[model samples]
Target: MNLSPALQQAIKEISSSQGISPEQFIVQTLTEKIGKLKQSNQTSVSQTGLKERDGILVFETESLNGIDFNELIAQSRQERDLEQMGL
Candidate 1:
């Protein structure tokens, strides 16, 4: 393929400095980046059931049944309001 003189000079310089052909250097760089990307994209599944749900899920720090849940619900509502406001 046709390459600019500056690019050709750069390839020669890199190849000589690294003791490898320009094509091999390029191939190695592409290979390494691809491997790293693939590794990073691999999401390891957790053995814990933190994400498992049978149906509609609700999250609450404490049940809203007695006086203990009053403050918890208030705090949760405040947090929800803050989230809605993009805080």
Candidate 2:
């Protein structure tokens, strides 16, 4: 793969700032992007019962294992607020 000179420079700068080699940075970035793509494709938007209601996105999956998403979000919000308050 060929990268533009400016992009190469930007990658070098970012990788150096992050204390990693340019190749390592590229590999890590590509790995993260591929993982997200795989995860997004794994969910069937049409047949998986995905919906948006009241600004919240909901989806049906067997992985939930009977957990309540609303309660989980509430707990996460509480934890985030506590962390913000330096708890």
Best by lDDT: 2
Per-residue error at 59 for model 1, in Å? 19
Model 1 pairs in collision: none
lDDT of 2 by residue, 1-87 (tens): 799999999999999999999999999999999999877865655467876679877875668678999999999999999999999
The whole-model lDDT of each prediction reads 0.72, 0.88
- The digit string of per-residue lDDT tens for model 1 on 11-63 reads 88988799999888778877999998866544322222223257633333455
Extract clashing residue pairs from model 2.
Answer: none
How many clashes in each candidate? Answer: 0, 0
- Worst lDDT run of 10 residues, candidate 2, spans 39-48
For candidate 1, the 10 contiguous residues with the lowest summed lDDT are 43-52
